[model samples]
Target: MGLDAFVYCRCWQDGLTPPAPVGPVGFDEEGYLSLVVSGGGYTETDAAFDGWTASACPHELMEQASEHLSNWTGHRLFQQALGAAGWSHFPALQAELPSANGGRMPAEAAVRVLDELDYFEQQAVIDDEVVLVDEATEAVALRYVAAYEGVLMLGPGYRAGVDPEGFFILDPDSDPPATLFRSARFRQRVLPSGQVQFSDEKKSVQIAMSPVGDKGTPPEWLRLEKQHQAPAEFGYIVEPLRRLCRAAVATGNPVMWC
Candidate 1:
């Protein structure tokens, strides 16, 4: 059986004992957070969560929120840019810079570089390693990315043109307001089992699309077209969840995912 997850929030005043575990873990109609799992579960009582006020986010929701923030920040692109700028390995640079105080680079310049490096590193980790996002999280991220990209397709100047080799290309240059250019870079190939596989490699990943009429648009693009008309609704759900994670972190609350 699959594991079900829940998010919760807890707060206590001075001289008052922390709230005892009550109902199951879940969101109730009255906006209360509970922990009553069908099979029963225990809430973590880490000292980090013992603050005067705190919120905990579910693992799945946290991953989804992270995906949203990553896209918004163009984190992957930023990392690639960092590499191009001669930062061989960002994490290594981050660690070494703090200790290499005797180097030729001035302390102030090093600090500035460290600050910018830290931002990228934090965005890359997003409070934790993304590898923690299991298959379940991957499924959610794929669907959300697809739907988000679809909604972007409805904007003016979004032209769906086929590359000469029948590969689909969403030309953002044609669409002035298109921030979804990265979405177009993803290529999809339908396996014989009808399952769609996605990749970003244009040359390494073989395209299974036949060079017939329409040049075979990736199903992902079609999904995006279907979603393009309802971008706001999509954002409404994802944005708040992202903010919840941010708020939880801001309050020094550690997000626990099962």
Candidate 2:
């Protein structure tokens, strides 16, 4: 399913005190913001900001955004890119990033990583309005922007086994089911059979797998990793997201995934 992200400010609405909105946090029945209107139950966005549009609104764009993203938001590729950049802090301590679409990034920290994202924003972010067409998919970044919604987290992962000539040709069994994720902390869960997952961007990524041939009809696993290897395409995700984080920062709220 697609992710529905919004900011939360625990104790902002209720009388309780707001805790440290950043760093490692485990899942809970009562999320950080238990009774806040922005806690994914209310349909109205706090009127304090304009950049953020709730996925529940009546606008058609938001309707589309409920299941998709646009030039303004971060999608899977962008999330993966952020993960690759934050890999240096993996294993011992998860980076503040919530690589997949679930979890929250305290507005303060999400935008604070603007330092981590500035280079990506400059080099990788997609122009939210007009990128280009991939002859194969018709629209590489276009359809993505249309997807303003997408995430689930992946736990620790491993490297892909490739062919003799060392090209990432699709492996129906493994590659088809594989994808990447970066998170604030690894979750403990039973992964269903037939899927492949991993971490360690420095050690496991196919950094030089296909310098140029990353295009064409590549599988999900290859495409995300290719974005990992290249810098130019990472922007498709950060444009909307960084803007959202900036908006959240302005509002002093926590970003939440519904």
Best of the candidates, TM-score: 2
| Reference-based TM-score, model 1 | 0.24
Alpha-carbon local distance difference test for all models: 0.31, 0.37
- Residues 126-224, candidate 1, lDDT per residue (tens digit)? 211111011212211222222133222222333332221222324345434432223333545567764335455433233222311223433332222
Overall local distance difference test of candidate 1: 0.31
lDDT of 2 by residue, 137-235 (tens): 433322222222221111234322221112122222475554333321111121244333332333233222221222343323222211114555544
Per-model TM-score, in order, reads 0.24, 0.37
Best of the candidates, lDDT? 2
Off by more than 4 A, model 1: 1-67, 71-74, 88-114, 117-250, 254-258
Give RMSD to native, each candidate: 17.2, 15.2
Candidate 2 error regions (>4 Å): 8-76, 79-94, 99-101, 123-232
By summed lDDT, the worst window of 10 consecutive residues in model 2 runs over: 182-191
